[model samples]
Each structure stands twice: as C-alpha cells, then as structure tokens.
Target: MSLEVPRPIDPSLHPLVTGNYRLATPAIEALYELVTRCLRYRIPGALIYGPPRIGKTRAIEYVRLLLARQHPRMSSYHAQCEHKPRHAEGPFFANLLEAVGDHAPHAGTSAAKRSRLLLRIREAAARSGSGTVLLFCDESQRYNENEYEWLRDVHDALDRQQIKLFTFLVGQQELLAQKTALQVAGKTQIVARLMVEELAFYGIRNAEDVATCLNGYDQTAYPEGSHWSFTRFYIPQAFDAGYRLVADSGTLWQAFEAAHHKASLPGSLEIPMIRIVKDVSDKSPF
Candidate 1:
C-alpha cells in the first residue's frame, strides 16, 4: 500500500490479479489458493483477514468468480457480520439453511424452520455430483461468543452433510488470535482440520491515519525516522483552492513519524515539481 497520490493502485482493475505485480501483497493470493483447494477437498478450510479496506473483500470476490467459472456446480453465498451484538445461533442456522437451498420464508421460530432446513441441507449434499458450497463471511471480527459458537457448529453440521462447503472468513487481525483461543476452549472441533494462514502487514507502514494506501510501513510505527523523510520526500503535496501545499508543510506528520521514529532529511525548498499520478501505479490503494 502507498500513500503517494500519484502512485495509485486501483483494486477494481480486473478479474484476475497476479501477485508478481503486487510485490509484497501475497496474503490475498495465498488465501485465494487455500479456498480453491478447499473446494477440491484438499484443505478443510481457510480464513481471509486483514485491516479494513486492505483488500480482503476483493480477494473473496475474485476467488468466487474463479470457482464459479471452473467448478460451475457449487453453491456460493456471502454474509456480512452484524453491526450490533446478536446471538450467533439464529443467524448461523438461517444462513446455513439458505446456503443449502432451503430459502425459508421468514419465520418467527427456529423450531418451525428446523425441519425444512435440515431437508434442504441434506438434499444439497445428496446431489450425487461434484457439487460444493462456499460461504464467505466478511467483517467477522464483530462475531461475539454466540457468533463464534455458531460458526463452530456450522463447521460441524457441514462436515456431517458431506457438502464440502468451503468457508472463507474475513476479518481484522484480532480474528486470528481469537480463533485460536476459541478452539482451545473446546468450542470447536473444526480446529484440528482448520489452518490459519498469515498475512503480515507488508503495507500500511510509515504513515498515520493512512495518508497513502497500503504502500510501505509508516515512518512512525517503529524506529525508522527515515520513514518520515521518505513519505515526505516521495509523496507529493496536495494543491487545493489556490493553495499549494509543499513537502515542507508536512513537518508535523514528519515529526509524528519521527516520534514513531524516523529522522528525515532536508530537501530543496524549490525543487522542480511534476504531476504524475497516471505514470505511477501499484503503490497506493486508490
């Protein structure tokens, strides 16, 4: 990820993105691979995670497209986490029921929906073909205990169905550690069969509140004061309302980076300027 406005990286550019161009953006590609494997009965499942707007949703959308094109016989659905607190139980069952093709009309009672839900779940599994189902849950960090437990149960129910549903969970960095804790608490059996992939923050450094996209690390977050200098040096100033903002005007942010720890250098106050956003690419998240 980069902050420099000139070097923008647009995530919606295409249907297929090879990591060879992204340099350090391998996390999404790796998560995409794991989901592909899960569809083919290779892995039990995998999760996709990162800071918000860091490309988690983009990865899932790409994978879903690939799977639909190549497989053509699987079911796919996406569920967003609740913004407010909720018992995971109802939503979990309802989602699973929908996934299996139950599509139950809204009901006031879970018990009333149970029979048809199980029927659909069983029927989807009994398709007697190379059929699979995938559920991609975004913003999963909001999942409370109820949601977490419901997730565990869903894993179990899917296993019993033999539907080979691949679940890709997308969430914050805490989701990783939280999953481990939940599994250890004996709330889940899918833990043994599940694997957590790592997506290190190769981007998002050398900045505060995110000036550029996920370019490099911020100058602050650690000792490299050169980061403050680097961002100031590389990122051009913003011009607005007849006011020309220069790199020197970045003094406060530079100091912020320095406090995080980077010592920048002084540059010419009257350096030649260039307008070059189009010339730059694959740097900042636009």
Candidate 2:
C-alpha cells in the first residue's frame, strides 16, 4: 500500500538548524570526497556517525542539497526514522523509494512495488549519466537489529542491479549502545529508544584531515565549548577571561603574541563545534 505521509515541513528551517552550525568542512569534504570516489571508482558506503544533536543530520542534508543543485541527475533518498515504518521486508527501502520516486508519475503501492521501482530508477539513473543513488537513513538509532538485517538483505538483493549504490547511515552513539546493550541483555526495550556506545578517542585523522575539517567548519558567529572552528585557545575560556570568549572570527592568539611578544599555539581558538550547534540552534539567534 502507498504509505500515507504526513504533511511536510522544511527541516532546514527547524530550530535545531538555522545558522547554528560550525563549518564542518572536513566532514562536508569527506562526503564530497565519497561522491567523487563513487563516480570514478565505486565505494560501497560510509556512515557519518557522531553523537546525538551534533548536527549530523543537518550537515548531511546540506551535502545532499549540494548534490541536488550541482548534479541533478544523481538521485537521493532521505528517511526519518520517526515516520514511515511501512513494509515487512524493507522498511528502509520503502523510505528510500519515497524520496527517489518523488515527483514521478507513479508512486509505489506497496513495499514490493517500491522495491521494483527503485531498481528501474537505478537503471535509468546510470543510463542517463546522471547522479548516483544515495540512500540516507537519519536517526538510525531507532532501527532495531531486525530492521538493519532487512536493510542488509535489500542491499544484497539489489547490489547487482547497478554498478554503484551507497547507503549512508547517520545516527547517534545510542545506536551502537543499543547493540552493545542487547548483547549484554538479550531482549531489552532500550533498542527502540535512541542510544549508542561512546567513541572516546575520536579526533583528527592526519594533519590534512584536521586542517580541512577546521577551516571548513563555519567559524563566524560560533560559540564557545561547541564550535571548535570559532575558538582559538580550545581551553576553558572562563578560567582565563572570567567568561567564555565568543569571538567567531580573527585570532586571539595573535593579540596575545602582539602583547607578550610570543607566538601562540595553532588551535588556540576552537570553540566546541558540538556545543555551539546545540546551544545556538536552541534559541532564535537568527
């Protein structure tokens, strides 16, 4: 059956979004890098995993918009876990088909129908020399082990249909936690709730990744403790200034150098990107 979708609102305008993000240039470039790699050769998939409310979904959406604007032929599907859990075999597939088939003459009548349409869509996508098909699932923590297994089955069935297909899953630490928790306690209700294990040692890969990610992050108007690209010292601001410094741009280290006649460190002003995204997006700063 054609799943009934609720009325749509622009997620970009949501409060959690709205000029409330660091540049995340490295992550954005990482996605763009994936796109380039996929078209040239073929990369299976990538997951933009991070902590909850860390702008994973927004950053991904921005990348998707970039793809749509630059490469209209490349197709994409975005499914929110809160909605449309239709179909037994492939719930994720059903959402994928919805975005892929949007604006088409015929939508799917059932999950199987959507699956069939998606195969044809991929074929058409390749022949036309258009955009690639990217299946993005946000809030993936809501997905159960059974749902993930179903997605794996869908990929196996359809992998041969096209030369390249990519599935990007974005979820919080809770997603990983649920699996670990399940392993600890066989059957638990916590799986339905968004939860995941922590990634304690996450940092820049090489010097290149750091440079790119830092600059790409929107530093202007960035807050302390969250938007790292905006801060300079990266230390507890209140300890030094008696209040958190909120300078979105310019180098405070340079000022210190001018005063003390000494060179300051490179990462002296990295406002916590995660913290800024959360706090700024909550209020109507725009």
Candidate 3:
C-alpha cells in the first residue's frame, strides 16, 4: 500500500492575511452600486469619503473586482496618493505613469510624461473593448488644487480622444473638506469635473450588519474549490458539529456596545471593519 501525504494549507486562507481575503459587506455593496451608476452614466468624477480604518480601500478593491466581472471590457487601475510637501507637475504625472505600470516613468519632462499618460490610458481604453477606463485614487485628500488641475488636463486630453475616463477619489473625511474649499475658492471647473458625486463609506452599524459580515466567513470557501470555510478551517470539529460564526454576531455586537458605554464613548456604537475582523479572527474554539 502507498502512503499519501496531506497537502499543506495555504497561508492566504487564514483570516489575518488581510488583503489576500475580502468579505462582501453592506458598505461594499453600497460603494459598488455608486461606482456602477458612475460608469453607467459616464460620470466624470466621484468621491468616496469615510473615517480612517473604515475599509474604504478594501471596499475599492472589492468594487474593482465586481466591476471587472460585471463589465469585462472595462479597464480599471488603482493609484495611491502621496503627500508631497510641494506638488510639482513632473512628480504628478510620474505618479500616474507609475500607477499605470509605465516603464522609464522618470525619463521624460512633464509634458512628455503627460503625453505618455494620455497614450497609455488611450491604449488601455481602446483595448478594453468598452472604450472606457476607471481610475481610482486612494488617499486623495493629499491632492492639491494644482494637482487636480493637472489631472483635469489628463481628463480633457482623454476626452478629446473620445475615451471616457471615470475618476473616483477614495480618501478620508478631509476629502469632503477639500471639495468644500475648492467650491468656496470658485474653482468650479475642477469641482464640476471631478467632485460632482459623493458617497460616504461606513463601518458595521448594527447587529444585523455584524451578522451579514460574519456570514461571509461562515460561507466563503478557501483555496477556490475547497469545502473548508474560514470558520471551518479554524474550528474543524465545531464546524463539523454545525457551529457557525454568524451565530455569535449578536454577542459580539452586545459586547462592543457595552464596552462603548463603559468607556463613555460618544455617538452611536459603530465598529470599524478592521476592529470587527480582528475581533473575530483573534477568537478560537480552544
């Protein structure tokens, strides 16, 4: 008789692997809906703002995945904004080039970089079969008016080519403040171009929300085709005995609510996605 060796578990299947895994929560569903509308209407720009650690970035990723699946012919790219003490046109275009996977991003002048950006984006849109592209900018709160002006130039250049560029800004609440500041400064051109639509991201708001998120762990499979879910992977015996994470949602919500009261925290009890995921991931049947 031949002895068989068991396959090693994939580390990515673990809940703590963070970016490697994502659960489709209600907030993500809302964000996806907004993005879908923006693309459907060919909206120039939209803003997604939320408090820090509220899963905005993750939501962006999830939405991107959904968009790719639903609109297979669309092109999408994600770029993270850097806080420069002083914004320059060269660095601005260079950042976009890098985000779009340009080679020799630093080998050109600002004008040349801008040209490259336009060409790359145009080519991408052309190849997408839909003639449209989505640009998601994270940490967009760091962008200044000048940076926006340069971005607007890119948008205009692409528009001239008949390629639709839908820019979505994902950042903290300061993004809203920046939009207000721009409006007050009479920079309506930029506002009209990019900030015409806005959506607020939120954390788990109630026991029902908690249950929905927990249900993802209880039902989502690991290794793409395996029967083992996150909950099952962590507690196989209990899982086989019919235990599920969704059953604990009410208890988790009650504990957090009580803790908020004990600490005298203000406002309604809203738990960040990171905190909720960490709380659940840290627990074990043992």
Per-residue lDDT for 47-115 in model 2, tens only? 455655445666667677777878777777676765445435444555555556544323445565556
Tens-place lDDT per residue, model 3, 206-255, is 99999999999988877657887877777766778999989999998999
**CA RMSD per model (angstroms):** 12.8, 14.0, 3.6
Candidate 1 C-alpha lDDT tens digits along 1-286: 3554532333343111222122122444466667765656655556555656555655566566666777776666666665764564556567556645565634536655555555565565466354466777777667666665555555566668665655666778877886788678875544444434434322223322123322322221112332232233334352222222223334533544564434344531211001111112334334
Ranking by lDDT: 3, 2, 1
Which has the greatest TM-score?
A: 3
Give candidate 2's whole-model lDDT.
Answer: 0.50
Model 2 poorest 10 in a row by lDDT:
192-201
lDDT score of residue 225 within candidate 1: 30
The residue ranges of model 2 lying beyond 4 angstroms of the native Cα positions read 1-24, 34-41, 69-72, 83-93, 102-111, 114-120, 123-127, 175-286
lDDT of 3: 0.85
The TM-score-based order of candidates, best leading, equals 3, 1, 2
Poorest 10 consecutive residues by lDDT, candidate 1: 270-279
Better of 1 and 3 by TM-score: 3
Q: Number of backbone collisions per candidate, in order?
A: 16, 34, 0
